[model samples]
Target: MDWPAVAAAAAAGLAPTTPIAVTLANRVIACSAAARAAGVRRGLRRREAQARCPEVHVVTADPARDARHFETVIAAVDALIPRAEVLRPGLLVLAVRGAARYFGSEQAAAERLVDAVAAAGAECQVGIADQLPTAVFAARAGRIVEPGADALFLSNLSIRQLSTEPSLAPPSRENLADLLWRMGIRKIGQFAELPRSDVASRFGADGVAAHRFACGEPGRGPSGRDPDGELDAVMNCDPPIDRVDAAAFAGRSLASTLHRSLEAAGVGCTRLAIHAITANGQELERVWRCAEPLTEDATADRVRWQLDGWLNRRNAQDRPDGPITVLRLRPVEVVSAEALQLPLWGGIGEEDRLRARRALVRVQGLLGPDAVRVPVLSGGRGPAERITFAALGDELVPQANPDQPWPGRLPEPSPTVLLDDPVELFDADGNPVRVTTRGLFSTDPFRLDAPGRSGRLSWWAGPWPVDERWWDPALKSGRTARVQVLLGPDPAQALLLCYRQRRWYLEGAYE
Candidate 1:
């Protein structure tokens, strides 16, 4: 919550003293201390927040921005304790036993951890308990309980804490706590004293978990699954792989190794992790999830696609600095192959998908990744803007969500052809046709003049004018006026022309 407001203010170059609020869906989700002082609070409507704090600076809540800026905080904690599990942007949990032992005491470790984060420019509180849930609550209260006192410290707390405390458990358990409250078990002590068998019989596994937490049992916290007995495929790229083809070639064998291992274990993966490390020590990881368990070819294809995306970034600056030095494929989630029931119909079988994958891989190898791209229809005002490109095996996500209303965006019957470059429009006298700031045509277009073709204009429609981001000069793309015109001596060809920066250019063509 604090991270969102701090990130927003930081982006706007506002000091920590500034009254700021971050809103999502027009409701205030996070507010700075100054904003709170001014009466702006969470859950308030944007207008209400502004009404309460007239000087408040409101920003749209961007989870991406929050996470990006919160990396500093994570880095700070990780410096002392590697691999801390981040529960949320601001909440992190880990077993600090080793750190405490090294520092000679838990409180000293907590103090140093707090100081480390403070040095990183964010204030943090630390808590230590025998169990995770109690430690989470203790952290919230900004206290460190002595060892073996987890139950005693939590006994008097309201039962709602189980539901409200984020690190303790999920909200489903909160519903159980609410039900317990209705039954007059209003404190953790009461819930802890309930018979484990009775709780399991009445409320089930979630209730049992809740009971464990309330009893201060060292419940399973995400220490990551037992890796000692786990099978993972790892390969070192000795000379390093800088090209997509090489990476794809290497990924195939590695995927085969992983599948063979899984096959021997009689299981198949539904969710798999692709982990790569650059020669420069930069780590890249992505998770691929499938409806059905992944086969050998399916796993290889996913790895290849992921490698292609990493290597074939359109923007050169976004590309990795060096070749990948290592690659790993780990099955994070799996189920027995026999447990999966194939659909009766209407789905492509594994063999068919594998064949399609091989065909795409061949095309990607023969032609470079960029040369073979899949077109995805995206939301945009113009025909040229609506089409986006992704690498052959890459996933396609819209440039902008089509569901959102885009004012002033052009309606379609989209044009059949989009010109690579705009063409000039001229009058019958061969004088340049122009558009005024008021959207009026200086002279009617009577002829179309492009590099290889010229023709007399037969008819035309529209001088549709659009002004985008006029309020912010930095983002403004300049004003543009468009027209649809037919030009030819015999059979006229219809064209879309746009006038901008004192020149007319061909935008698209109709069939």
Candidate 2:
């Protein structure tokens, strides 16, 4: 999450001390320290955050953007520690036993690791505890507990810590903690002090497991499974393929090979890294995380996604100067296949989702990336401004923060068909019905003539005034007013019309 702040700071040439918030789905997901100081916090609505910090830079939370910037930090940590589990783009955890032993003490190891991350242009906190959860909480507080003090350090923590402390907490643990809190068990110590057998009988296996963590008992970490060794599939580009189709073809084969090998070994990866090297030595890499164990098609889809994100640039400047020379898929974190629980009932089954994804990939290959775009909600008063298209495989971030109060947005029952070319609107005299400079209608819209039908207006809704970006010269599209009108008498059809530049046009249809 900090990566978003870090990325925004770097991109905008602003100091890391500047207040910033990365918004996703119209809520604050991550905020910089300066923003937090200004009363901005996680989960706050965007408008509330803006009210608190008017100068705060609001950015869209793009996981790909975060991961792309985070790769340097990973490389830096890997230089110090051979392998570290990247729990997410920003959060990472690695066993410090070896590093501490080599450095002669845990404190010394933590300092060196922190300094390493600092050198990579990121501020990081390192903490050491016998257990992973305790270590993570300690790291957030910038503290390290003594080797045997893990349980003691966690005992006094509030039950709410179960939800907030960890990057990802099991839903069961969160629910159990809430239940315990209602029963007056507010601290971790209280829960831990309960008889283990009783807790198990009351809350089942998840409760017992939470109890163990609460007592500072060492739980199995990522190292428990031990990495299966360089289980990555690599594809070499002999002539340096530039077209997305060719690169995707190679990715499909490599993805198949990688997944087949993992399935044969009876394990599956939860997080996989897609690494690519351009002909000019520019390194492009991304990590794709999955909720369920990745199947062959799932793996291939990710490969295509990462590839599309890199190769399909919206502008010339965004595109790499050289073609990709090498592409690699490395399993960064693996889980037992049995750990994934397949849902029995849902909207669409896994097979259907996979098929849909494959179809999207095929379209991207055939029509180019920009042709198959996905809509991301953004802040704007106008219909067109409210949604921006993101290229397929691009980590979708809003173009505008949706939580902002758009003064003149169209009301509910949005138009379904947005016309590419607006049909001209006219009056009974065949003269264009115009909007005046004072935001008033010059004449009533009496007749409607278009491609398919010609009829008198049956009914009409008011011309809602909309004036956007009136000051910014580059974006000033001038003032316009919209009206929802019923075109025909029998089972009247709805049409959204806009008036600007002394002319009226059909903008969309409610059908």
Candidate 3:
């Protein structure tokens, strides 16, 4: 609103010579007069601010803190006005009709608002008008115009202020004002005089609302409360955290926020979104989903997992110097409160599946999200083509029975040891004879090797040469090697292995 008042208030929180400024990461969100006079303006980078105002006091914008502080100020106002809606951080909207009647005038209510914010350790400029946007601009402009004179008051103001929607667009406030000047709408009053149909056809709905706002007409009803209101809360840091540890600490705060919100709403959340704001004005957003509704511990675990995920995804070339300043956690989907239902007879393995899912998530946190997977049967004849890694909790399509049994398919009970990249092996004699490229290998009758002695290869099996998917390039051109092996008990009653890659390696035993 009033740049001077905002500057003064912001400066009051800093050293006298400190050029106070607010930034959302690297971009300046707001700046004091002293800072501006030194050439520091909103949207300037932190480096640019330092270059312009060497003594600038930079404070990262903390929307949650501002929101909390605003809530306290509004609570005080509610003590007097009873009903109020917080439109944004540092902005409050109230029905002044009742408050004005009680306080004897709208000016009195405005004064009270300013006084209340001041008492709450904040200096705010209050604006009183019929339209919310007009009042907002009046507040920012640092003026309190009479209720009935809003049109006259807005007429002289730049049209840019009418189009201000902080949460939506990125155009500079001054640029919007300049555009209005070029459009020959020098004042809010002139813009308001334009036909609504013409305004809507040209500038869209936002423009129409701005026009009505300039006319001093109430553009809309009070801001509606978001249905997922319990998902909101603020994190306050002592001495202002500015390190990586601060982000970790903020994660705890986010967990607490979610816990409180969910407790109040009597529900649990299935998904949470964390928004981290850095001192340099950068925002990192991450979303976490749980297979089951989460508890407080689970929520924290998810947050930690998300942070790790972010670190893994970022390039080593660029990393933040300081810790995150603020972390906002919002639960996007809240599930109804329900107890875990256990089957009386336990016919299906649902409990085991749930446990497996949790274990997979834990492993993912330790190894990396993509490092672990469950093998699912995909409809195909070849071994490599039939098996696919599935993410935890994903539904699996059953493998179809081939029109004819795969002639070379391995016998029941697949090998227990499965390596991602299997090594090649050779026979004891160092001969090149081994398993076929298609998982078929001819082995001479062999006996198992024992600690005391070695036996001969006995009861050799398949030399079944099976051709795999020759059509698919990804598999055919690369991993199309076939394999053949012999299965028999060794002298020690343990199964021994030999394969084609010009060497002998233990594949596995057949129990």
- Identify the leading candidate in terms of TM-score: 2
User: Tens-digit lDDT track for model 2 on 1-511?
Assistant: 4668887777677898999998887799899999999999998988799999999999877665665556567667777976566566677777788888999988999999989999878899887888888988888778989878988888888987876633446655668878999999989888889999999999887787788889998765644232334687888988797876677667876776797678667778877778888899987655555434676766666676456556654345656668999888888778876765546674357558756766776777678767788898887766776788987655566777787677888887778887634566667677877777777667777878777755789888778877876877776456778888997777688988877655667778888
Give the range where candidate 2 is weakest over 10 consecutive residues by summed lDDT: 220-229
lDDT, each prediction: 0.75, 0.76, 0.55
Pick by TM-score: 1 or 3, better one: 1
Error of 1 at 344 (Å): 9.4
The digit string of per-residue lDDT tens for model 1 on 1-511 reads 4778987876677889999998765678889999999999888978799999999999877644554455566667777876565454566777887888899988888998899989877777787888777777898788988889998999999988877644345557768888998999889998899899999999987788788888888754535443332878999998899987779767876886887798789888866777799999898765555535776766777777667656764345556789999999988778886765547672558558656766766676667666677788766676766777877644464554455566666667777988856677877788888888888888877878787656888889888888775777775356877788887747778788887777777888888
Report how far residue 28 has shifted in candidate 1, in Å.
Answer: 11
Give the range of the ten consecutive residues with the poorest summed lDDT in model 3.
393-402
Estimate the lDDT of model 2.
Answer: 0.76
Which is superior by TM-score, 2 or 3? 2
Looking at model 1, the pairs that clash are 422-506, 423-506
Model 3 alpha-carbon drift over 4 Å, by segment: 1-17, 37-39, 165-184, 223-511
lDDT, candidate 3, 159-256, per-residue tens: 66644655222234445557668988776778778889987887764565556667877554342333354576556554445543334445654675
